[model samples]
Target: MPKFFNTAGPCQSDIHYTLPTGDRLPQLEKLIAQRNYFVIHAPRQTGKTTAMLTLAQELTASGAYTAVLLSLEVGAVFPHDPGAAERAILDEWKQSIKFRLPENLYPPEWPDTNAGSMIGTLLSNWAKKASRPLVVFLDEIEALSDETLISVLRQLRSGYPNRPQGFPHSLALIGMRDVRDYKIAGGGSQRLNSSSPFNIKVESLTLQNFSLADVKNLYKQHTEATGQIFTPEAIERAFYLTDGQPWLVNAIARQATEVLAPDVATPITVDLINQAKEILIQRQDTHLDSLAERLREDRVKAVMQPILAGQDLPNVPNDDIQYLVDLGLCKIDNGQGLEIANPIYQEVLPRVLSYTTNASMGRIESRWLSDKGELMPMELLEAFLGFWKQHGEPLFKSTPYPEIAPHIVLMAFLHRVVNGGGTIEREYAIGSGRMDICLHYGKVILAMELKVWREGKRDPLDEGLQQLDKYLSGLNLDTGWLVIFDRRPDLLPLSDRTTTEIATSPAGRSIIVIRG
Candidate 1:
């Protein structure tokens, strides 16, 4: 029984290759020892459950406290009914404690209580009768919304004053978001204007993703156990693509080792990691698919729309931006600006947003492809112009985000071209004012830049040519295209405004300038 990379659930030490729990989070012994209640949050599958579960077991084993991690997720079905939710949640707690603790440490029988207060009552009685101090880690704390969420928070806060004598010595609320972001009611309303009921928490801490060093160490364990080698380049590439997100780190390794190169004698290389990444993105694994689902969320879209289009974030609420960060959709890069969390997410987000339009383009004629399957830049340009004249406006209505409909529709068209045998890599960021695409097919590569001319903005041809010149130099390509999507309200119809011309970049590269 050799250990393997785990992506499905909490890692089990004997069965999964994992970093030390102590390395993943700050020392909490002092807080628990002092009877402090705190919040622990992180994105889904980043090992919050594993860390807290292992910590609870280790603390109970130390003989100084009775500890266990339980979940409120099972109670989510009763979101509006606090009494039922509490009863269901308490039952799970009793079962967990019985399984995790010795008979001497088991909680006493529950008290008969009316309606919604059973959660607090049960905790108080359990703490009072325990041989040692009791510590509880409440997992999935965000599942309850509205009245149920408020009720649970207030109950936990009320029990804070009676610690070690009438209530648990320490309690931790664990979830994917900080308590303030929790929705307090229906209709997409958040807790923006209200004071939290669980205001007793001393600190709101987050479980961070693994670091590069942690990733290297975790992968090295697999080599040790199975004699399979992950090349240094592959390890760094995985970290770059996933940004050390726990599930993604494990998933990429699992896909490479288990599916792509199962033989221990076959060493994993950078190319294998890239192939594994494509497989993961195409398969839409549970982890990636769940994240893609958030692209349609209003809060998520508000922040993501601009980043995807290389525009500035304006008028978007700070809480909404933080919500995206908390969910691991985006990050404030180096305090410089907001960007997608990682490279893989950068790829996945646009592809998911353009899925419908991309799919609608069926059996695309390979006019831009040579007999050897190589791409031709001029052929691609002609094809795009013809497509824009015929179908661009109709497909614009098919895009997911209105702010970047032109970009999305364009990507959808390119996806059709790349879907056959090529790859399209995208690079865009907040305030860049343009999106860049590098299309690869066979031995041929095409570079392009996209800019939008909105109302009150000047023509972007000059700026676009200058930017494309810099971009072409980086790719060492002698020619590229600059597409300025004129989305001004006063513009003529799509058929009448679409046209193209040739120009020279500042660096003397041939630049194809398209205005549509």
Candidate 2:
């Protein structure tokens, strides 16, 4: 069968388009060779499984060690029952070893042990039987929760002294989080002792996304196989949109080649990659949906809510911020500070946040469109003004984040434009209390900035004008919209207070100023 991009599961070399998984993490061999226990983590679908599986095969092939990949995910089903979880994990490992290692390399039968010491004892007996030193990679270690997670960690740590004889010579716990961030069932990490569980001597590492060179090499494989090409611009654009996210890189290419264009003769272009992005967002594939699900958690909200509002983040725990970074939702740039991880994530965040308001919106007519189906900028503006008069207050009451309520309402309104075949790109000026939207239609590109007039703060008109002027210049447009929504405690009713008028920006460009 012809090789294709694999997204549903770990990439297999013979059947999937894959890169050298080891190249992404060159320290694995050295770390294992040193008989160190370490942790491997990254956001979900980041090729952690694939990398570990590949590494296991390579090490076992070297004949110096017996290595195998095992998973604890099935154990998660019995969060509070360490015994049952351990049994299930071991049963799964039997199959993994059968699949991963040669028959002669398979260890003697698992050591039958009581509930609490099953994992350690099993590894001990297996290592003693193996012809070579044993190396094990435990994937989805975080899935073993509550008593199970803590129990497994302690067992592994307790068995550390028996390495090369009684226990595996090298072991790695793999999951989406670092050792410190493992989730306990029903609550926080308070259930864990600071150092009792996984304080083994070694390093904690993350598998990074593909680099630009990796992306280029990956796409080159598809080109070589199919005789179709990804233009230089398309590869760069894909890298930019995805930040070399493994799932996203394959997803975009898969969507383009398999669904969007599909013809091997037709080259994959930048436009197709852009279209694939829209489809993936619409599809909300399992990976993206999993990320969206994280948005509802309070831990995620503590940092994200402020980031979404363009306000300075409140005093949140450092781990809370790192939680997001670990999840790949946000990253800290040295100069730019904390921001969304990549362009695709930045685009998805606001839309997912405002999903409820977008769904609650009543029917929208085509009144804003010209006869040619082109979006009439003024008509669309009028539609928003009318909608705000009727639904803006309710939207505010319904918004999930009060600090970003107006911004969400505006996005909800603009989503209608997107449904009418237009697109809106947004940028948030963090700590500036502002968001800018650039709407693209057939030949009309409209720019707008949203700012709030909070209590104790003067009207933001002058600052907004100066900002919008720069924004408009960036769009190479001579005009744009600056909206100031009054959010003070004593503000008047929405219908009565909303108003719009024409003005000039600081750069002498025509500006539509809307103060509500």
Best by lDDT: 1
lDDT (tens digit, per residue) of candidate 1 on 1-516: 899999999899999998877887756887898899999998899999999999999999999999989899987888688888888888887788778888888878776798668888888989999899999999998888878888888888898899979999999999998888887767536662443688899878888888999999999999999999999999999999999999999999999999999999999999999988888777778888899999988878888998988998889878888889899888887865889898888888899999988876566577998887778878988888888888888888888898898888888888888875878889999999999999888788889999999899998888998989888889999998898999888778897899888898888888888889
Candidate 2: Cα lDDT at 210 = 91
**lDDT score of residue 195 within candidate 1:** 36
Q: TM-scores for all candidates?
A: 0.97, 0.97
lDDT of 2 by residue, 395-427 (tens): 886777777788888998887777748777888
lDDT of each: 0.88, 0.87
Cα RMSD to native, each candidate?
1.5, 1.4
Report the Cα lDDT for residue 85, model 1.
86
